[model samples]
Target: MDKAIIDFFQNFTTSNHFILNNIFIFFTKIGNLGMIWILISLLFLIFKSTRKIGIVSLLSLFFSFIISNLFLKHLIARPRPFTTYDLKILIPLPKDFSFPSGHASASFASAFGIFLSSNKKSLKWVVITLASLIAFSRIYLSVHYFIDVISGVGIGIFCGYLSIKIYEKIMKNK
Candidate 1:
């Protein structure tokens, strides 16, 4: 079942080359670029109430990525999909571990953080869709295995939820 899903996305990587290429480039760059996330954090900081939430979310995502990619990756040292398979890699080969995608983690961490902070149900759905799309894009680009993406989503969601709960507790205490 998992192989089928990975194979399906691998096929899309070739069939939807144009779209996947653009998406892969976007995600690859944005996921690694700290400047973009810093800028986003700054934007959120402009609004007093959102500032703290933004900081917490950003910190949570950073910590999650560090633990997953830096510590855990080195410890587990799982190989990337392209390394183990015959599929054509749409993006440049990632030098780091591939068990849990950092892109999916950061994307979902931000999306879910925003969803938790906002009162609008519609916006939550929109953010959820974006998170899902980012996760799908990772698989479609052949950069991440099915398990990697799923684990990333789980980790991201947990970090996002934990950050929100911590923020709420801190705010209430103050």
Candidate 2:
């Protein structure tokens, strides 16, 4: 089952490259800028009663990326897909490890964090959709394997949930 999924993603990575490439380029560019936007949004969250949740969410995401890249990547040492395949890469190859996509992890962590902090059902779906797009973008660019993106999603969701739980615990204590 796992191999089938990996094979499917690998095939899709190649077959969908054209479309994914374009979307990846756009999102990558936006992602560069969106980091700043997320910071600002986080700042806005500070003024509300939900400040603790926002901080925990943001910190959880930041730490998750740091630990993933700084520790896990080096420990696992997984290579990028292009390293093995004669794949035509659409974007410039990243210098970092590719086991778990930092972009996907960070984006989804923040989006899910916000979604959980706020009870807005509509906004949660929007954030989730955006997170999925970001994850797909990484695979589309040929920089990360299917497993990498899947790991990212898992990491992001875990950290996001942990952040929310911490916030809830803190709220109860206060």
Clashes of each: 0, 0
lDDT of 2 by residue, 55-162 (tens): 766766776677566777888888887776666666677888887877777777777787778777886787788778877777766677878888977887777888
Residue-wise lDDT of candidate 1 within 7-114, one digit each (tens)?
887676677668657876675566553344456656777898768756766866776677676776688778887787788776667888888877777767767776
| Alpha carbon lDDT of each predicted model | 0.73, 0.71
* TM-score, every prediction: 0.84, 0.80
Give me the runs in candidate 1 sitting further than 4 Å from their true place: 20-28, 33-38
Error of 2 at 44 (Å): 3.7
Model 2 accuracy (lDDT, Cα): 0.71
lDDT measured at residue 126 in model 1 versus the true structure, 0 to 100: 72
Which candidate number would show the highest TM-score if scored against the true structure?
A: 1
TM-score of 1: 0.84
